[model samples]
Target: MADVEDVQVVVAHQERATVRVGEVFLKIDADQRRTDVEVEAMARAPIPTPQVLWRKPPVLALAGLPGSALGRLGEPPTSSPKAWSAAGAAVRTLHDAAPPPWPGRTLDEVASSLERECTWLLANDVLPADLVTRNRRIAEAALRPWTPVFMHGDLQVAHVFVDGDRVTGVVDWSEAGPGDGLYDLASLTLGHREHLGDVIAGYGAEVEVDVIRAWWSWRSLIAVRWLVEHGFDPAAPGCEVDVLRSQV
Candidate 1:
């Protein structure tokens, strides 16, 4: 039998919990629909993903990826530029593949959510009005129509696993669906703007820089509240708050 001492809580919040034991991960989610999407997305993704070990209601077990995550929030990446570029290439491959059958948010939906979040932030005095206003203007560029692609939806750096200069796998597919390709790119480079050039180079296609920038703001602004409520400190160095402040 596996030793109970090996278990470690990776993340825990009101809605879900993820624990690691030996070389496997156990995810417990409140909503089964999200797990359904995660299973489907992993099956559909063209790139490498953690192997699904087994599934039982509310508990999905997965084999661990081979390497450490590409990076973490609030810290500079130690991985080489080549690794960053490899992640970009992996993203491009996913985007080029057939999109997921499920629908994603429309531009109007994103705009509405941003409006609602901004109102909450302002009413609660969570951030300065000027900071929110400036970032909102920057986020406008992303509200334009976009061609849909298979998106990881939460392609944050920590979700990507790398071995040396190659991408080994990507995880966390709960939000995967047909969405803007640039949003994935933006998510990968959110707090690591210095790596944007290397990632864009590896993406190997013409992309609109301004639109990517717009997603940075949109993602950061919309995530602050969720991050806080989840017991994460968005105000920590190199986090969502820093990403917003960097625009100044």
Candidate 2:
């Protein structure tokens, strides 16, 4: 394996960079990059994001926050509750800062993208129809009532960085979109009940987390179905099927 440091890894998980007009430009991974660019641009955010520092087609300058891809607790505070409160506040600040409307894509466009990805998964024989149907149900429920808000579509602990209870930064900008806040919450906790409960309690919002938890449970079941049908690899870990089995 190549060292990430030696390679000057400007962008990863997509492809290599190319040069044009004596300057390096990154080729956008059409499957992913557009949403990242749009969401960051829309936010016009104060916090530094990777998308804003575009170099060229596939390259961008990194902000050099000293953390791993899975985030780091740079310093430990004396109290966990205090640390949790501060981290929650930081997340609220980021979400409350509104972004511009994502220019061209409509709800229909997003639906189409979902369909395409689901179709691709099915074609590859990597997922099951039962999972697809369940995913659709959860998605529809999430979208049914609320107006769209900016969502970190794939939020997780890995994207979060903390320095002694203070949030230093959020790392990935890809897979961002306009969607339900709870959807973002679901992704963030990834069905970890305790963690999800902590985040909800910390937020202190009026809304019930039960609805969100329901969505998360349903969504998680879909994921488990996919993994089971697809055949698990030794490198991957999941208990989604176990959770579903308990429910049944």
Candidate 3:
């Protein structure tokens, strides 16, 4: 039903797609799952982000990537620690940019998103029952009361891009919101824990590293659960369900 073409979905999730439109890029949500589009549209001008192309029914296009996600690149940085440090600095800049309340979101909203994933898995008869209890516990621990700040809810390495060891752009804004910034830090830092300490420290929030690690581990577990539910191969990279189960 949509007329846009030359379509290339650079990154995709359960409900949205990132497509190119001429010189710019657009994120088109076929299912109106997140209500923050209009708000983001108004507020993005002040933030250091890609130029938004347009937003109408069934299509919200924005600037296409100036580069690819850093994590997905085949080569590791000459100094991995420095690369992550730069990423933390970048996230801080994006979060500090002024914006209004992103409608239909709160800390509770984040908790609910995790719950819904579990529910979907269970309904599909794919969730391992024992793992379900463990996930619930992790989610409970993560749903703490905290000040709301802009968070890249899905800030994984693959969602980032780099050029000459310098971060060029970050893809995917579907999960952007106000929450714990440390959680976003953890999402990108956990897998590279050895180097992460310096990275988080460079971000100027040494106190939050432990909390960020907890969230980083929690999200890894959730990703495993989602993969199992969707019938994807868990042996693939980033699957942490087996490790999570061992901890139980």
Q: Which ten residues in a row have the lowest lDDT in candidate 3?
A: 70-79
TM-score winner: 1
Which pairs clash (backbone N, Cα, C closer than 3 Å) in model 3? 25-62, 25-63, 25-64, 26-61, 26-62, 69-160, 69-161, 70-160, 70-161
Model 1 spans > 4 angstroms off: 1-5
Q: After superposition, how far is residue 103 of candidate 3 from its true place, in Å?
A: 4.6
Ranking by lDDT: 1, 3, 2
> TM-scores of the models, in the given order?
0.98, 0.62, 0.71
In the predicted model 2, the residue pairs found to clash are: 25-56, 25-57, 25-58, 26-56, 26-57, 26-58, 27-57, 27-58, 42-100
**What lDDT score belongs to each candidate, Candidate 1 first?**
0.93, 0.49, 0.61
lDDT of 3 at 89: 75
TM-score of 3: 0.71
Best by lDDT: 1
**Which wins on TM-score, candidate 1 or candidate 2?**
1
Error of 2 at 121 (Å): 7.0
Q: How many residue pairs clash in each candidate?
A: 0, 9, 9
lDDT by residue for model 3 (1-248), tens: 46666666565666666666565766667666453544363356233455555668677666655555555322343446667777777877766665345642566666777777667667766657767666567556667777666676677777766665577767566666666776777677545555576566556655555466557546755576665555555544434554344335
If ranked by TM-score, best first, what sequence of candidates would result?
1, 3, 2
